[model samples]
Target: MRDQEPAPVERATRRLSTKETAELLGVKPETVYAYVSRGQLSSRRGQGGRGSTFDAAEVEALARRNRRESTPGSSPDELSVRTRITLIDEDRYYFRGVDATQLAARHTYEEVAEWLWTGTLRPGARFTAPKESLAAARRAVSALPEHSSPVDRLRVAAVAAATADPLRYDLSEQSVLGAARALIPTLATAPPLLRATYTDGAPIARRLWGRLSHKEPDEASLRVLDMALALLVDHDLAASTLAVRVASSARAHTYAAVSAGLGVLEGPLHGAASGLAHRMLVDVLDRGSAGLVVADELRAGRRVPGLGHRLYKGEDPRAQALFAALEELPAAHAALAAARDVVATTARHTDLHANVDLALAVLTTSHGMPAEAGETIFAVARTAGWIAHALEEYGERPLRMRPTGHYVGVRPPQPLPTQTGRE
Candidate 1:
């Protein structure tokens, strides 16, 4: 017989480097590692066992899964909104293309707010509440029950302030800007002050400090609070931000748009996380260990608050920035230690990281503020973001945010049930 054909040689599967895998998945290399740690994908040592490599086919399959999960029914281009204000990519975020943490480090909250609103950093920018609006907001907030949450008080204040402004219906950029400037300060000063030393014309953070705590604030503490506000000024299209945009798409005035956002913020998953974190920290401090507290939270089927965020695969950038600031304050040492302990204790079970809520809890607990103080700070700080979203939405087509309903319930034409006659 003619020379037997050589048996076909088996070929090894193709492998991809980490950089290639990340590019294929449309994420950063860190995110690729995060996926591996989470068990969503698998990796093997490359030739000579030098670097991890992913199966090429496996990476493509994961890319498909991610696309399916992130955009379920609609295409990304259709469901997404174009925005020039904030961009969250990888684990870091930006405000107007500038690093948000850097902005918070270099500028006051007012200056950052001005930059977000107009794309220009106005040094020494100041926002003053209109006296009439402030008085009306305070009156409305005072009428609520004593047990009303800070967000409740804020919603009432927004409505009251709206009534005081006769030109709220005017959607002109200048008019909206005017309303935004007046409304933010009005909201900041509307809550009942805990101390009698409240001073007008101070920065928003300074004014807010008197409302949240009675203790005298040191300059370092004040710096932390100011930076917190600046850092929290906006987070791109959060649940509350979406509400504000939807309301604005319907032509709601600035105050109403903000009120719509506040309504959504009161949910436990959104704005109340810091308060839960505050309570958890208190529990950890009292029990003298994070292990027991973490176990109890898991046993109760509740997620450990302030631990992880949906948008971040690594430590929250906001938390990182705030933690660095918190390190300088002597008073924050105990709470800061507790937060770290909590993170370490939880890491054994999950790959989660500390989020902004944990940092806020450290601040509030260390400064003698009540649990609800974080919610107040969030509501006040996010109002600026709500206004900015409202301004952008105003320029879009009216009712552009309205989504078509997908009826998954019983199909439309069921026979009407005849009412039974009572004997």
Candidate 2:
């Protein structure tokens, strides 16, 4: 005997029309057809062939994947990437199951990076560079113009270091970690290693401070910088992290993957946000009123730069943590007041809240660093994150992030013999 057919209601519950599927996926009708074409969601013609109907379960799965893929602009809503390094919740960030805020407050950037690279936060984790790589990095930086930005110098140094390292082709876990360890210090422009007895062997943050500033290092400021770097070590899969992963998925070396990440970070909406925030802060400082500057910017149809985040509904935890650190220093008073004023004014006028970019701007300028220093900090700190993501992708199936384009161009070429003469 033939099997019984399911009831109409049951079938209706399991199926969705094209329009309904488009709404469910937050895409257009064309996108629904493309999904069907790509086999992401199965579809069949309706009775009498009027419209397309999609499997409801498949549409729902695609919706979930789209949501997961939507992050930080550069990552399009197509591929769902999985990572165990970091998780961004509504109000908190976790790095390898540990609260990033807690880790930021107490740990060095090296320790946080080690934790992200491996699941364990071993106290013995160290970041040191070989002498040959250091020389290559110095040569690369020396070759750049005097006006080159920190990130620019770092990028050149990265390429040079990669070229110099004979073992850079190794994709082994330990070998990759070793290259990462060697690469970061070079990128930071650390002074040449003399001897174990002569060097302070300070943490990454302190060494970075020395590289970026001419002023003598303050212990308190260095501590805050360490916290900032720790907090920024990883965040889910940011656009740059996704870029790094995409490169690593193709079996690219750690330096190559990081170079790809830096390319993404150079975008205005990504790593350059800190510098933009600094400009906004300077505007407030020059105008002598944070509220006035913010209101004027909004009136001019511009957003108060760095005042809000898409992911954080209230305040970004990184911002709050860095703000708390700022509050500890007397020198940060003006920057803190500007930040609070912008926050309060924006909150009164709109739903936005202060984010890490503003906090970073405040931290840098308040300490007498240039406005662009914030971008430098972000780039340096995020290098660790990109490397961690590259490592994660190296373990996955190679080239798995290659996404198929949904063709939306004109139809295929066809014979038009008679019409062609008229045209």
Which candidate number has the best lDDT? 1
Off by over 4 Å in 1: 1-78
Q: Report clash pairs, candidate 2.
A: none
RMSD for all candidates, in order, please.
Answer: 14.6, 12.2
The global Cα lDDT (0 to 1) of model 1 is: 0.89
Give lDDT tens digits, candidate 2, residues 293-392.
8778879997778877777888999999999998988888898888777788777758888889999988887877776677777887898999888876
Q: List, residue by residue over 287-338, the lDDT tens digit for candidate 1.
A: 9999999999999999999998889999999999999999999999999999
Would you list the C-alpha lDDT of every candidate in the order shown? 0.89, 0.79
List TM-score per model, in order.
Answer: 0.82, 0.77
Clashes of 2: 0
